[model samples]
Target: MTDGPIITATGVVKTFGGLRAVDVDKLEIRRNKITALIGPNGAGKTTFFNLLTGFDQVDAGEITLDGQNITGTPPHRLAAKGMVRTFQLTKALAKLSTLENMKLGALHQRGEKFWQALIPGLWTRQERDIEARAEAILQRFNLTHMRDEFAGTMSGGQRKLLEMARALMTDPRVVMLDEPMAGVNPALAQSLLELIKMLPAEGRTVIFVEHNMDVVQEISDWVVVMAEGRIIAQGTPAEIKSNKAVVDAYLGAHHGEDLSKVELA
Candidate 1:
C-alpha cells in the first residue's frame, strides 16, 4: 500500500442559513482504495463535496491531498493538482462532440505551448499524442463509436460514461463521483458500478457518494455513512449493513427492533 492518505480532512464544518450541514470531525481517504460515501437525503454529502472541491468556502477546517494543504484552492487549480470529480448530474457540453469534450481536458496539460512547438518537432508531436490518448480512452469506455456524436444526443448512460472518460483526460490522482449511478439505466448502472470498482485497480483513490446500497455493497471496499450532516459510521460494506445507527438514520428509528422481532418470531 502507499504511504500517505490521498485525502484528509480535519474538523471540516460548513453552514448555510445558520444550519450546520457537514460536521465531519475528521476523514481520511487512503491511497488506491475504493471508498464509498453513503448517506440519507439532506445529510450534506454534496455540501461537503462542494467545500472540499472549493465550490463552497468552509467556515472552519482543513483539507489536504497527499499531505499537501489545499484547503481553499479553487476548483481549476485543485484539478490541476490531480484532484478531480464528476458531478451528480452529467455536465457535459451539450453542443460539443464527445471527442471534442475530451480534447478540452487536455488543454491544461503541460508542454503544449507555442514556444514548445517552436522547436519544430516537439510540441506538435505532443499535441498529436494527446489526441491519440483521448482516442484510446474513448475506446476503453466503449465510446469510440460515439466520439463524433454531440453530447446532447447521447443517452443518459452514455453521457455518464463520457463524463467519467473526460475526468480521466486530466490524469488525476483522486477521482470523486457524486452519485455515479444516478440517472443511469439498470444495464448502465451495472456498467458504472463495475467501472467505479475498477478505478482503484489503476492506482487512483476512488471516492463516490451513492445512496444505492446494492451498488455500494457490491463495489465499495470501505463505506462511510453520513446522516443529519455528520459522519455516523465508517466500516466495510458488511459492517455498514449491520450498523444500527445507519439503519435507524436511513431506514427508521425502529428498524433494528422490527428486524430482530421478525427474526425471533
Candidate 2:
C-alpha cells in the first residue's frame, strides 16, 4: 500500500570460502506489509537475511533502510536505527530471566554506562519504564507468568515467542524473522501467525523466511521465491502459486507432474 519500499538492496552478495551463499541482484521490501521469502534448503534465504540485517557482511552491495545507506552496519547499530531481526533459532539469553532478556533489547539505556549507572538518579526512572514496557509485552505474548524464570527453561515454541516479543522492545520499523515457525508446536504456531499478521497493522514492516506455503499464502501480501542463491520470482501469493518459474524452482525435476502437487518450501 506504501508508495515505495521501506528497505532496498542492490547487487548484494555473500560468500563463504569458495561458495557464493547469496547473490541477490536487487530486492525491495514493501512498507507496512508482510513479505514472505520462501526458498529451498540451499537457496540462501537465511544468508540473504543476515546480509540485509548486518548479522553477516556482504561481499558487495548497498543496503538502504528508509533511504539511508546502511551497508555493512553492525547489528547493534542497525537495531538502534529501527532495523531489527530474529534468528531461525531463537536467540534468547539462556541464563537470563525472561524479563531481563527483554530489557536487554531496549536501546540507549543510561544504566549501560559505568558512571551513569552508578548514579541511580540518572537511570532508575528509565529502568522502571523499561520494566513496565517489558512486562506489558510479556503479557501480550502470554509469558508474564515466566517473567522471572530463566529463558533456557522454556520450551522451543515459547522461546520463539520470547525472541519475537524481545525484538519489539526496540520499537523497530522493520522486523525480519527467520523461520519463526520452525519447531513451534501447532497451537503456538497459530498464535505466532496471528501476531505476525498484526505487526503491519501496528505500523511495522515484516519480512520473513518461511518454508510453509500454507502459512505464506494465508498471511503474506507478497512472496519472493529463491533457488540456488538467486531470486527467481516475486509477486502476490496467488501469482506466485501460478508462476511457472516458482513451480520449477521447487519442483525442477518433477516439472512434468501436476504443478499443484508440488510442495513449495
Which lDDT values do the candidates have, in the order given? 0.84, 0.91
- lDDT of candidate 1? 0.84
Instruction: Please name the candidate that would achieve the greatest lDDT relative to the true structure.
Output: 2
Task: Compose the digit string of candidate 2's lDDT tens values, residues 125-179.
Answer: 9999999999999999999999999999999999999999999999999999999
Q: What TM-score fits each model?
A: 0.89, 0.93
Poorest 10 consecutive residues by lDDT, candidate 2: 255-264
Query: For model 1, how does the per-residue alpha-carbon lDDT over 113-140 read when each residue is reduced to its tens digit?
Result: 6576457565666677888999999987
